[model samples]
Target: MKRLAGVGVGWRRQLAHTLDTMEGLGFVEVLAEHLDARGPLPEPLVRLRERGVPVVLHAVSLGLGSAEPPSPERLTWLARLAERLDAVCVSEHLAFVRAGGVESGHLLPLQRGEDALEVLAENVRAAEAALPVPLALENVASLFEWPQPSFSEARLLSGVLERTGAWVLLDVANLYANGLNLGTDTRAVLEAVPRERLAYVHVAGGVKHGGLYHDTHAHPVSTGALMLLEELVARLGPVPALLERDDAFPPPDVLVAELDAMRVALARGVARREAA
Candidate 1:
């Protein structure tokens, strides 16, 4: 697969105009659940396609890491949307949002036990079988970690990629948040993940609430997260990264400037890599 260079943003209705006018955006990812696979694509998104920007379909409801099999209907919708948009790929969390028929209402981290790994591997294969394009698994940030897990987060993610032959959508902010909360080395997390399998990277903002840095994506990108992103680019050589701002929409100019900052960091990393 071609490495995605430059910065992208998660396509939001509120930022449509900003995204449309922005220069040098490498790609955008649209939330799959917001779209109807049977209907015509959103006009703005269609325009992006017309402008030659790659779109990736991102899903939150698949609950792929659940003990149960992935929802067939959700997978079908993702497949249809991907085919319709000619997306670069389809991605979902390596998390389970529901269990025993109960919805968690938020993405929940999975236990890194052997059983969980096997279950996740099976679900990933099931998803890949149904997806028209490649399925990439994203690592999520959590306030808590499973006790006495059989593998580290890096090992579990790499195992899933190995078992299913899928892609890794490494979220740098999530890695930083996890490090802050769990007290692990965030840089080690970045280094340990299988860089060759990385599909892209995600950068988002968060706030320190009650002593924990939340990966809320509702604030500006923190300095530490940007630094981690630079480290990732230094290791992987300028993989595609999208700034994810889900709420607290900033002014268009501010968002553009944030992207510009990321672009500069990415360029520095690539230049250093090339020089080395």
Candidate 2:
């Protein structure tokens, strides 16, 4: 894949029009929950292929960061999508969303420890084996952090990556949201993530309730998230960066403009780096 510029719209409803706008605006379009194997990708994805737009797969329920192994059913679906789309990368949350001996509805937070590491490793390994593209693990904007005997967040995450040999889809906005909500120092969290290991950035907006933040990804990037994103792009260099807006969706013009702003900011940064 060629170098991806600043922003991408999270593929949501009205996808045809969204792709049309994104194409006109030079924005990459990230594929949505089409990770399911029911049949082929959602019809909107075909429009992207016709337009020759760059596409990446961002999964919501891989449950990689959970305590369960990647289920055979999920693996079958992912393999189908991966082979069909020729995706740049496939990604899921670092937190487990499914629990139960069957199907858990909640996106569960894992206790940061050795046992958790084994769970993450096995899941990632199974996913990597099936999908030809790079397998990516995303940082969850967790509402709670479990008390662990030892292994800090960085240590646990780094250990999983080291053993599994996969990449990280760093969600900078989630990092900030966690800090804003849970009082977890976002910078310390970012440092724990190996700078060189990041494959892309998911930039999005969120809301605050009392002391907690929800990863709504349904608005323009927050002022604080924007600042942190700038630092990330500058330090990490030009990687595929995507904007996720999943609710209270806006008209295409407004969404495209917001993404364009992010694109310009990132381009200026890349230009400045070259001059320096």
Please report the candidate that would top TM-score against the real structure: 1
- Give per-residue CA lDDT, model 2, range 14-118, as digits (tens): 545666545543344455454455565667666776676666677776788666577777777766776677667677778777666655665666777787778
Give the alpha-carbon lDDT of every model.
0.87, 0.70
How well does model 2 score by local distance difference test? 0.70
- lDDT: worst 10-residue window of model 1: 184-193
lDDT tens digits, residue span 1-276, model 1: 545556899999999988888888899999998898998778899999999998989999999889999989888888989999998899899999999999999999999988899999999999999998888889899999888878788788768877888988989889889999987667666876677778888989999999999999999998888888877777778678899999999998899888887887788777778877
lDDT of 1 at 81: 91
Predicted structure 2: clash tally: 2
List runs of model 2 lying over 4 Å from the truth. 1-6, 24-32, 35-40, 193-196, 267-276
Could you tell me the C-alpha RMSD of candidate 2 in Å?
Answer: 2.7
